[model samples]
Target chain A: MRYGAEILVYLKEGVLDTQGKAVAASLTRLGYDDPSVRVGKYIRVEIEASDIDSAKETFDKMCKDLLVNAIVEDYTVKVEELR
Target chain B: MRYGAEILVYLKEGVLDTQGKAVAASLTRLGYDDPSVRVGKYIRVEIEASDIDSAKETFDKMCKDLLVNAIVEDYTVKVEELR
Candidate 1:
């Protein structure tokens, strides 16, 4: 069997996204006046695991310990088993 | 008119995805054993710009000057005209 996880991490609300802001400003410069652009990063990961449970535990740990910084960023994790 | 950009950036080939590696190791501990997984991130942006060309230029400049560090990461940018 195989397990897979997809993680999305992003800045918490209230944090200024300078890049997103600049892009928005440029849009006004270009002429489009109503488009809304927020910049964010998404990570898609595939992994080999023993089974679903361990895959889940490990992934949760992975997110907390490594993938993202909890204070400034918030993340969601999903795990599925492929047999 | 509105402008949008989507960017996909990932670590260049040969750089060990440390977290990715750890996730792989944990999978073996769980029991399902044949899935291969790799991790990567995606970003979607919507910006207000003067027009298509300027939107495109600012975006290109955006990527080189700020969005990504060219050495360790590789990225592709796409722009679309929205109404």
Candidate 2:
């Protein structure tokens, strides 16, 4: 079976997001009203797996091993069977 | 009123994603099987607006003006009223 996983990787709360801060400042300067911004990564992966559970397991492993920075980041994964 | 917008910015089809290709190669080298990967940006913005419709309009303007590269990238915005 084939599965598609959408992973959202974000900075942990209380972590300073310089990029987000810069974006917010830019928006405010450009005259957008009172905007707060946070930026993150959205990763889509297609994987071969036997079942949904295993596919999810693979995604978890991938996040822990390579996709996410555990010290300052957290990630959420959503999986669906691909046609 | 406040609205929160979730914007996903991704490379258009046929655009080359070098970072994604690098990540995929590294994952394969680390022994994940038969994985295809694409990477994008997830931006969460909180804005003060009169209503959801205007909030959405703000987001579209943001994307067009700054957040997205219209030539090689595409973006989708999801907006919700913030309590």
Candidate 3:
């Protein structure tokens, strides 16, 4: 079976996201009011695995190893069967 | 009313994502296999607006003004009423 995973990776609280800050400044300059703004990475991947559990395990490891930087980023994963 | 929008911003097809490539290389080095991978931005915003249409309009403007780089990126917006 194939599974799809949506992994959302965001800067950890207290982490300085310069890109986010720049965007926030731009928003304020443009006169759009917002409480705050933060930006992060979103990745979608399809996995060919025997079961949902294995697909999740593969994605979790991918996040740890290559996707999310644990020290500066936090990530959430949503997995669903594609077939 | 308050509405929530999930905005997904990704590089357009044929655009080079250097970050994604680096990660893909690292994954290959680590022995995890996937068909391919790409990385992009995800933003969630709470909008105080009259209705879903207004919320979508606001978010679309935000994306055009500050969020997605339309020249090199494509974005999708999903708005839902929040309470």
Alpha-carbon RMSD of each model: 6.4, 0.8, 2.5
lDDT of model 2 at residue B76?
Answer: 91
DockQ of each: 0.29, 0.90, 0.53
The candidate 3 chain A region of ten consecutive residues with least summed lDDT is: A30-39
In model 2 chain B, where is the ten-residue run with the lowest total lDDT?
Answer: B47-56
Give the Cα lDDT of each candidate: 0.68, 0.93, 0.83
True contacts kept of 3: 0.55
- Model 1 steric clash total: 22
lDDT by residue (tens digit), candidate 2, B1-83: 98999999999989999989999999999999958999999999999888889889999999998899999999999999988
**Residues A1-83 of candidate 3: C-alpha lDDT, one tens digit per residue:** 88888899998989987877777778778877763567888987776898999989999998987788899999999999985
Report model 3's interface C-alpha RMSD after superposition on the true interface residues: 2.0
Question: How many clashes in each candidate?
Answer: 22, 0, 0
TM-score of chain A of each: 0.78, 0.97, 0.94
Q: For model 2 chain A, give the 10-residue run with minimal summed lDDT.
A: A27-36
Sort the candidates on lDDT, descending order.
Answer: 2, 3, 1
- The CAPRI classification for model 3 reads as medium
Docking class of 2: high
Task: Mark the regions of model 1 whose C-alpha exceeds 4 Å error after superposition.
Answer: B1-83
Scored by Cα lDDT, where does model 1 land?
A: 0.68
Candidate 1: tens digits of C-alpha lDDT, residues B1-83: 56877776777888777755665566555553533445555555666677999888867776676567788888888899877
